[model samples]
Target chain A: EAEVAQSPRYKITEKSQAVAFWCDPISGHATLYWYRQILGQGPELLVQFQDESVVDDSQLPKDRFSAERLKGVDSTLKIQPAELGDSAMYLCASSLDVGGMDEQYFGPGTRLTVT
Target chain B: AQSVSQHNHHVILSEAASLELGCNYSYGGTVNLFWYVQYPGQHLQLLLKYFSGDPLVKGIKGFEAEFIKSKFSFNLRKPSVQWSDTAEYFCAVSPTYNTDKLIFGTGTRLQVFP
Candidate 1:
């Protein structure tokens, strides 16, 4: 089965350091999403993209967090000067389109820990 | 803004025991409901979803959910649970049927003993 792929399944870094995670959505998928899952909490949408253009980023903390999807196929999320509270599981998901009717497929998340 | 509510924080059960998880959404308009499960160290997988027509929806792994419009509830039920069923389940909602955003509830952690 075609699956979304994520890199750096685990990450540990000191506070104030910079970290980045990568994700490659399933082929032909036009909509990509980034979510953050804190321990004991459900995932929250951070950003969403439609064919390389950001559709929604209202919940993303722009101060130090940034995400970009280049060429509309792969995406990268970065956090500069990471904070302890920023530790969480970063999830990537994709669907055929931006329509809510289509099911979204998820990728194994990257677990980030800040010391 | 719409929100999802999952009342059960954690549940423990033995093999062959019945399981039920409560999920409620605070949307008044037509919405989409979904349940996703995440196994230990694994990614979230769709358990089931409800869009329209059927109030009762059947999902994988012998699971089913009933959507009660009056109560604004969509509860997940499993007749018999196994040790392998230990996982965290999340309830999510799309505020509007055609909207692209999804809001998730806190989640429920289930631990099944053998």
Candidate 2:
């Protein structure tokens, strides 16, 4: 089965350090999403992209976090000067299109921990 | 903005026991409902979804959900469960059909004991 790919399944860094995570969506998928899952909480959407163009990033903390999907295929999410509170699981997902009714395929996710 | 509510924070069940997880969404307009499960040290996986059609939707691993439009609820049920079914379950809702943004509930952790 075709699946979304993510790199750096685990990460640990200092509070002031920078970290980045990568994701490659399934082929032919046009919509990609980034989510953060804190312990004991459900995943929350951080950003959404449609064919390389950002559709929504209202929830993203732009001051410290940035995500880009340059070629409308693969994406990268970076956090500069990571904080202890930023520790969580970053999940990437993709679907054929951006629709509420459409099902999404999820990647294994990158677990980030800031000391 | 719409929001999802999961009634149970944690659940414990024995093997072969029936299981039910409550989920409700607060949306007046047409919406889409979904349930996702996450095993230990794994990413979230879609268990089932309800868009249009029958209210009773069946999903993988002997799971099913019933969408009650009037009640604004989509509850997951399993007649018989196994130890492998232990995981964290989340209920999510999308307010419209055009967007992929989803509002997720806190989630319920189910521990199925052998």
Candidate 3:
């Protein structure tokens, strides 16, 4: 069973510090997604990537958040000058393609805590 | 914009008890519905999905869901459950083709007791 890999299972940072999380999806997956899961709430889409190109980032907080998938393999999500409310579980998921209603496989999320 | 709603926030059940979780989506066009489960200390895993054809879809661990287009509902049901089934379940929807951005509803946390 191919599983998505994530780094730094847990993170603790100061409110004004910068934080970054990494994700490596299953091999040959062309579509990748980043989501934020607040406590007691479902995951929310932050960004979507097809290969190395971004497809949708309407919900991403561009001012402080950025995500990139170079060469369409692994991806990195960064939050600069994190705020207290930015603490949440960041999940990364991937699928075979952006179409065809493929099932997306998710990685164990990186839990962020800002104090 | 598409949105998913889960009626139950938390549910408790004993072993071998039947289970049903309500999920509704707000989208007029063609859509794909799915149910995902997250066990403690584990990542989200796909339970089942509804794309087309048969409205009733069966998934792993004896789970099933029916896609009621007229009601915009995709409710998950299981005839019998075990203590291992205790987990958080989420309902999600995405537009067919084009993009695959998923909109998920607030999860339902099920506590199955033995």
Instruction: Report the C-alpha lDDT of model 1 over A54-115, residue by residue, as the tens digit.
Output: 99999999999999998999999999989999999999999999888788999999999999
For model 3 the local lDDT of residue A39 reads 97
What does DockQ come to for candidate 1? 0.77
**Model 1, docking class:** medium
lDDT for residue A53 in candidate 1, whole number 0-100: 100
Q: Candidate 2 on A1-115: residue-level lDDT in tens?
A: 8989999999999999999999999999999999998988888999999999999999999999999999999999999989999999999999998765567889999999999
TM-score of chain B of each: 0.96, 0.97, 0.97
The docking category that best describes candidate 3 is medium
lDDT of 3 by residue, B4-107 (tens): 99989999999999999999999879898899999998889999998889999999999999999999999999999999999999999988854487789999
> What stretches of model 3 exceed 4 Å from their correct place?
B97-99
Evaluated against the true chain A, what TM-score does chain A of model 1 have?
A: 0.99
Residue A98, candidate 2: C-alpha displacement in angstroms: 2.1
Stretches off by above 4 angstroms in model 2 are none
TM-score per candidate: 0.96, 0.95, 0.97
Cα distance off (Å), candidate 2, residue B78: 0.8
Residue A27 of candidate 1: its Cα lDDT? 99
